[model samples]
Target chain A: SQQGEEDPQALSIQEGENATMNCSYKTSINNLQWYRQNSGRGLVHLILIRSNEREKHSGRLRVTLDTSKKSSSLLITASRAADTASYFCATERGGGTSYGKLTFGQGTILTVHP
Target chain B: EPEVTQTPSHQVTQMGQEVILRCVPISNHLYFYWYRQILGQKVEFLVSFYNNEISEKSEIFDDQFSVERPDGSNFTLKIRSTKLEDSAMYFCASSGGFEKLFFGSGTQLSVL
Candidate 1:
């Protein structure tokens, strides 16, 4: 099983609506990063929140991290059709061997209807 | 904004043949990494390079795989003997100080 897992593998939302996706992980992490990917392309860094930090925001993207639950959520406010893509959460886990390397989640495919 | 760039957007090679994928990471960034994702699978980290050496690598990065920052801007990942399982989209990413990473468009390799 993957270290990070995202819920609602697929989501559909109307334009101007908000889309929220959740990610759960198994281990302790130093930080969690969110990335957006268009079809057939690479990921684009969206936002990152450290374990010590609870929430962060950039533009319409809002990210929240809960270390106690070992989970995070990305909220896209007033999503447009252009925001349609897959969103993945990657974690930098704690410990010796797996430090600094990111373990990605299965990802949630988001679709915005115009 | 600076973006990482990769060449040979798509390549097709035969089994057992050697293939080299190239990436030009964002200038002034010191950390470089290589990741791959097979179709319908999550992205997996292969290796991370810093200070002209490998800082960390996943189990997927085996003896057949190698990464080099042969020059200032270009970082390359080479596979000695390609197998069918090697068919996937390879992504290159770089970070400056913090963990805010930027990724290249990616190079899709198809092993026949």
Candidate 2:
């Protein structure tokens, strides 16, 4: 069973617009990470925010974490057609020695038009 | 600049046959993992390998499944008897630590 669930199953935006996607999980987590998958080929690691940290940024991506609510959001600013893809949020739980075994959400498909 | 690599981007195996999907993780990575995604489904964790032994696995990883690091570099997932249900894209991942993991291009397994 998957623990994480992403909101907005699909989104379409114009170029240069900002896109936001939300994710919610059911259990305590050590950290939350967001990933982007293009054409269902391979996933690219975007950003990771730990439980202690409230926010993180990398290039044009910004991620916010709320441990108390067990939710996180990813904001992509100045979106381009190249940003069209499926975005997923995966949670890392604590107390498990099998690290990096992520429970992923049913990703959000984002499409940016020119 | 290093990343995990998977061979035979696509594999078609017959039912009840044995199939071994191979992966080569990053050189310095200590932890390795396998994940599968059926079309239009969330990526599911199968198993994790570290220190040359199986560390942990999900319920999906059953007796029919096994993982082995045949060499210092290659990690392989073997299905003793292939089933149509096993058809999916299998991804190999590696990480230096528990926080971040880099994934491979993934091998699409098609069971006929």
Instruction: Using TM-score, give the best candidate's number.
Output: 2
- Listed per model, the TM-scores of chain A against the true chain A are 0.94, 0.96
Query: What residue runs in model 2 are displaced by over 4 Å at the alpha carbon?
Result: none
lDDT of each: 0.92, 0.92
lDDT of 2 by residue, B17-71 (tens): 9999999999999999999999989999999898999989999999999999989
**Alpha carbon lDDT of residue A41, candidate 2?**
79
**Candidate 2 chain A — worst ten consecutive residues by lDDT sum?**
A92-101
> Residue A84's C-alpha lDDT in candidate 1?
94
Pick by DockQ: which candidate is best? 2
Instruction: Give the alpha carbon lDDT tens digit for every residue of B41-81 in model 1.
Output: 99999998988999889889999999999989899999999
Q: Candidate 2 docking category? A: high
